[model samples]
Target: MTRQPFPRLKASAAALLLFGMGALAPGAQAKEAAPLRPQVAAPLSSFDAEVNTFLAAYWRMFPDAAVAAGRYAEAARLPAPTEALRKQQLAFAEQWLQRLAGLNKNTGLSAAQAGDLLLLDNHLQALRWSLTELRSDRWDPTEYNVADPFAQLLNKPDFAPLPQRLKLMDQRLRQVPAYYQAALAKLSEPSPLHLKLAIEQNSGALSLFRDDIPRAIKQAGLKPAEAAAITAHNAKALSALEEFIAGLQKIEKAQAGAGRSFRLGKALFEQKFAYEIQASVDAQTLYQRALAEKEALLQRMSAYADQLWPQCLAGEAVPADRSDKIARVIAKLSERHVAPERFVEDIKAQIPALEKWVVEHDLLTLDPSRPLVVRETPTYMRGVAGASISAPGLMDPKGVTYYNVDPLDKYTPEQAESFLREYNHWVLQVLNIHEAIPGHYVQLLYSNKSPSKVKALFGNGAMVEGWAVYAERMMMESGWGAVDGKPSAEMGLMYAKWNLRVVSNAILDYSVHVLGMSEAEAMNLLQREAFQSHTEATEKWHRAQVSSTQLSSYFAGFSEILALREALKAKQGSDFKLKAFHEEFLSHGSAPVRMVQKLMLGQ
Candidate 1:
């Protein structure tokens, strides 16, 4: 899973004016003022001005995001997730969306500005949909994961003198009680799963306060009195958080159906898929596409398994059943995994090898100066995904990016083995390619160089995830892990299995969220179809419930990006270069593929 920035609340005016007033007024007069000129003919400068105006307002509404994005002028503050703040954000979105709609699209916008317009429109629509339709603050207790903001503030060394940064953090720490209080007031009819997760996650936050905060305080070398004051505030906040978790546990005990339904159903799921993915197709189309891809991937895995069966089994008779053959071959290969204790270290070791391969293959350019640190996953962020890349935000260029891997030490022997088997040696390489190397870490590092901070701040998840999945395949296709300059069938088979996981991720997300697939069916899909272990499947089920449309991102993005590459290859013919294609694709920041394609191809 990709690590997302904490959600920032964007406030707006309480009252929504008529559509044709304010920013829309000038836009509405476009036809009358310049009757013959197309909106596309408008000066590029005008489009840039409009973009600036919109972003200025956006930063005002989401100062927390501004601060996170490295806009110190906005103030170092945490978002106020109060009901009034929600209403304000919704109103702001509606106003801007209408204003954007009123803009002349036929004359003035340059290709880049047009792309930005599409992105901004989708962003506003998504915000509105999230507030009105999803209403996460009301039912999803995980929305109150306060630890992320505080931790983010402390972790990044970008701000200033240690004391100044600590001062800002202390202010945020003091606000934590009110944040949780607002959360308590807003939340109602929460899902049991959400409540449980919130309790566990908040407990993790308490640990952060008890452990990491004190360490950070000492590291900063704050004055004793200042440190004592901060510690007092942190203690108070921790007590409030503990009290809140206890209250949630009490609610869980009292209510039979404690949590609200996690399902988005067909309609809401379609809307979310459209806006979140910004894809050309609808949810049903994407689901069908995923199903076909799953079948195709499984077939490919079966073909590889057929060839490897004799070798893997070491003269043991191959299973007669085709399904059994595939599963057996995978299990045999998984035996080559790292020990549980060495999992994180082993992952770290794979980085340089992958980087060397990328550079040797001339797959993409690398920036040596960008610092990427491999670390254990933070406690609050654990239990959702095994590994994730937490890249530096656009604003914090000097900040270190973390490749967080959840260690296997905490799991039972059986569970740990299952996790290990899922991330077997070969597959782990593919994962490192996806999460680091030429995937998120590299992609995000390039993104920070983008001139458009708007796109950087409001990145498209599909594009981000899709690029990573594409990187996995790209590395393999470029002859990665070839032994003695000869292609290894074992590596190829493992890569195919990893692709199966990607396909299965999309299928599981849609099935669970839209079709309401049961645990038994979901497990069968992951374990049997996707070749995942029981432990991996269980966590994926939880992830699918908590997140919608995200799991599908890898497939949706991979498909779109691949299609773009193929099209470019055909168009450019002999002139087509892989490295150029990769650089150009990522150059557009993390906008939706459609917009990126439009800008790149000049469509």
Candidate 2:
């Protein structure tokens, strides 16, 4: 299945009592053994049973999601995304939300139980919000893309016996036409940007089925007839998808020059931001903080540029404008990147070195057995990102995690150069640190070990992205690329520029969706202030138009995690251990930083 995007807090007087023990501390074994405490255990057990029942029913509603999460039951088949299914999902969420509300939060609950309860509530709220407020089924054509389920099932080693998985793929493939029909009936007044993305993505889906499916079938060693039948089914599905695309194109042509609104506006943006970020603050607060942080980062970037200006200019006249000066220094640094053809392989080369660094430094513990593979981004999943990690679900921890990097072969030389310049050699290391190494790859392996599947399956995006961003900084601070005995100043400079990109992502997301920022203003913000290349700026503009709130997660989450670390250090004083802090911080699965804080700090 398409990997979900994966989110902070404080020390108080209760913090000492809570964080004094590690996050994985046994829930007072002495108390659990006491005869009288059975009363306490009974209610907690009841809560677990109730929540488990709810989840089973809920997963049945989205069987494809279940399969993606590593559940391989026969019931875990793709369901048609019909309006009836949507209504049923909405009613199911509402019904469970009420039933869960009947459970008392104040009494007879273990810490783990309380945390899981919080997760279930958040999950339900998010489901309700998506169905009722977001209404993606009505307007977002990308929601109907049928290629991902089949691709994920076939591509990943989730099922045993190739034929079993292929049969499941066949089942989903035959239902594609019905799914498309449902989508056609549901989608109306679609956003222009979303429509364009959906078209590109569906076209990529065609490529995926045509080019990738046969290879997968061959690898699976299916019988000749089985392979033929699977091929025919996929061909039919692709044809239906093409017809759906034609329908979408008609809609696009009819609405030409009459740009449908992409903005979520102020109210919806805040609500979605709250649900997605799951932080204490609202969207406006985060936006204002991002603005302030951007200015601070600019000053830091200027100092770093000043240090490198003499070297970069080689005695050429310095620019009078400070922003121009910083840009010049960064441009010089970006000159060291790999060529377009070598991009994917170069990224692959960095992973092992980074893993070595983490191991030598005793940065969080590494799992030698859990495999992480670097591969080209799958066709259908591209257009939105340069790279991403498709992590194994908690239920299927043994599954291979794919770190997908988009290739630069498709772009013209000028475009590819612009893209490469933005992701230079030093920045590439930092990017690897974020997407692989001790970033998404490492964080996710740990996530699979989380005691609570609720937190793992419904992880907070802010926390996930935040940890990756934070990991980039953590590695740099720990002297990741030291030359001889000295740390690499060039790496530090690249990191600062990358952090600026993170902050600007928040600004751009809020501006396009809520502030209604003009193209010129957004471009200037990304290019001039954030030091992004023209190509990167242009794509980010499209990303901002097609998505909302998600761009802000990196900054919002990184900020919260940083604050939590500082608080922990201050509370622990000399007792603080970086390894312990990391292990503890990540122990809560991918729950909101606030929930983690409560669990860790006894709040």
Candidate 3:
């Protein structure tokens, strides 16, 4: 999960609306009337002007995102999530769609501009679809967390002076009550899963008001009266937050077993897959591909298990069942994980080793100046995925990119042990590879450097996630974790099991949302088929319940990226260089793999 500065109101759609629009160079209007050749430049100029206007308006619609993206002018405001704002955003999207359509008919758009046009069109249509169709605001109470933006404002001390930033926080605080009130006004029969998540996350968000804000007030050394006024506003905000959570609890009680299902259902799930993933293939087809890959992975895992059986499980007869045979060997290897206390520490320690390995292998260039900070996941952002990378906004490319690891201190001993085994020594290394190193951290840095802001801002999840999954295999192929120029049977088996999780993610998401796979069946698939630990499987079930289409990102992305590499390699023949391929592919930012394929293959 890529952490953004603001909440994603409707899965990827909100990410597009908020995070995507945040990153393009702030002064795009400067290019609105750049001098152009007589005939060819006129249309492109008009197109540029349209884009500039759209972005300015887009920022107004999502001011918190704008603030995070370094548009400090929006720092003092919070747009109420009310019917008025929804209609305004919908009108904005529709107006831009028509304007873009008019511009696209012009003959002189450069290929890059054409691509940008496509991205903008898709983005607007997605926003419209989200408002009209997905309408998560009506069902997901988690959409309206005011604490996220407030926390970002206070945390970004370098952006402005303390008093000034504090002033902005005070301004935003004034509107918190209205924000939650509007949120409650819109929400009806909220999903039970999301209601619980909103409560848990907001409970943590209350810390910003109760603890962080007071500390900041003291540290800033504000005047007694000013501090008291801010304290009063904070009190009001706190009361509003408590009231909102209570309202959600009331709804939860009233709905009992009658709340909206978290499942997106088949039609909505497929449409969401199209809009969010923007992949070449449909969800069902990709799901079937994952099913086939699952069988292939099992066969490969069985082969490695057979090879290691004598060494790891000495003299014990191999079970006739393929899964049992593989699970036994994995269980033995899982014992080699780090101690519970050292979990986050171990992950931080591996970042450098992985970086060094990638540089030595010439897999990709390492930017020494760009830092990847490893830290505990913030309280409000803790419930989703266990590990995620929060990339710096494109406007602040040099800003810190955090690799957030959920701490294990809260887990029971048994739960921690199960999680540790699932992320054992070998699997842990692969996880680091996926979330950091040449995965998201590297990919996003390159994304920030992408010349096309459209591609950089509105990155395709499949492309971003695919590259990470591909990086794992790429590193392994480049002799990472190998012994005597070949991967050891143990490493090979563990890698297969880890990769199986990616495949199973696609399978699980499709089955649960589209095919109505129950928790029992989902657990069977995760523990029995995928060989996941009990804790890991249980957490995944919750994730699947809360999210749709995201689980499939790993497999969908990995498959497309691998296939694209082979296609490019096939076309280039011996002229292809590994590092060149990686750099060139990532140079396009995180555009959909199919789009990148067209650009790379020049078709």
Show pairs that collide, candidate 3.
Answer: none
Q: Candidate 3 local accuracy as lDDT?
A: 0.80
lDDT per residue (tens digit) for residues 558-592 in model 3:
89889989998899999999999999999987777
Which model, 2 or 3, shows the larger lDDT?
3
Best by lDDT: 3
Q: How many backbone clashes does candidate 3 have?
A: 0
- Report the C-alpha displacement of residue 6, candidate 3, in angstroms: 10
Per-residue lDDT over 350-467 for candidate 1, one digit per residue giving the tens place of the 0 to 100 score: 8888888899999999998887799998888775777888776676778788899888878999999988988888888888999998998998888788776556667677788889
For model 2, where is the 10-residue window of minimal lDDT?
11-20
